[model samples]
Target: MPLFRLDASIMPATSQSRALADLVESEWSAENPGAAVVRRDIGSEPLSATIWREAVTGGFAAEADRSPAQRTALARAAELADELIEADAVLLAIPLYNWGVPAHVKTWYDLTYTDPRIAGGALNDKPVVLASVLGGNYNPGTPKDGWDHATPWLTRVFRDVWGADLRVVQRQFTLVGVDPAMDRFADQAAEIKAAAEQLAIEHGRAIATQVQSLAA
Candidate 1:
């Protein structure tokens, strides 16, 4: 009955993604009191950049022929895979950086893909909520439309690739108030924030219910 939560925000204190995730987690907590929660803050405790390479190489070599680093990398991959496999539900809070997925998050995906079970769709039919935030608006018809390279990729991985029963809660224009130049979008940002927050809570409750049903 464990829930796995992963946060990938370098600035934890001021992270809008983390803020949204907190709302989701709060709702989940209300539904499942005292339930186990496993957390991994990749931004604060990032995996080694070389782990993916080492694990990939290790996969091709005999156990006795594998280097120590490769062996360690493979073991780490298995551990990451196990975390997700054992969880009843998962919540991933990630933010867009430079219009793309953060480097550390990408590394995590790469390393985890080394595990045979994960790569083979271990999360199939599992409940997952992806809470993501964007610094600027990237909706269609906006100036930055089509510039968002993170969400689509994330959706593909979580929904299509892993076959998760996925729900996405996303907020845009998160920098409207922070950046003076974007003050004109304050009202729009407020609306988007409100909507995203509501969705986060709803998704949280939905996942919790689904998990409880599965357990029952």
Candidate 2:
């Protein structure tokens, strides 16, 4: 089985989201030893931000009437979409930036969505694990409640739009130890991190089990 993994962290060396994703991926790999894993690091190798606009226009234009840029953009969109379409499962390691989705992730989704296969629900029922992290707390009753604009949007796209069997693992207060101002929450942060890590392990094993059952 092929697994498609996308990392949207600009700082992979110290990315909490990537750490969680690693757990999930390791379990999947253990279950299917030597399985192919396709990786796309959009944060480091970002897509052309302008390509999405060109792709949209290209979709409306005739082949002969399309500009060179438009043709190239459309082709790129197809390539991005093909990766997910061909995958048996997917893992997205994304961190909340500025209380919302990273610019690179947004651009990637925009360009990929222009592809007909994805728009037609090619990812329907595909298993997707989204490992997301936040530097601050945003739970209900907290000061930042409802401030996270990334998780809900991500769920909408994956579960509602793409029809994926999505499982989300989120870790909040990631900056508790790193940021001096949040030092007061060290104990709470540790607890949250531990719980999230455990969830990551469980979700990873579940994904592997689910995929193996389907293959059987």
Inter-residue clash pairs, candidate 1: none
Index of the highest-lDDT prediction: 1
Alpha carbon lDDT of each predicted model: 0.94, 0.94
TM-score of each: 0.98, 0.98
Q: Candidate 1: which stretches are off by over 4 Å?
A: none
lDDT of 1 by residue, 131-172 (tens): 999999999899999989999999999899888999999999
What is the clash count for each candidate, in the order shown? 0, 0
lDDT score for candidate 1 against the true structure? 0.94
**Per-residue lDDT for 60 in model 1?**
99
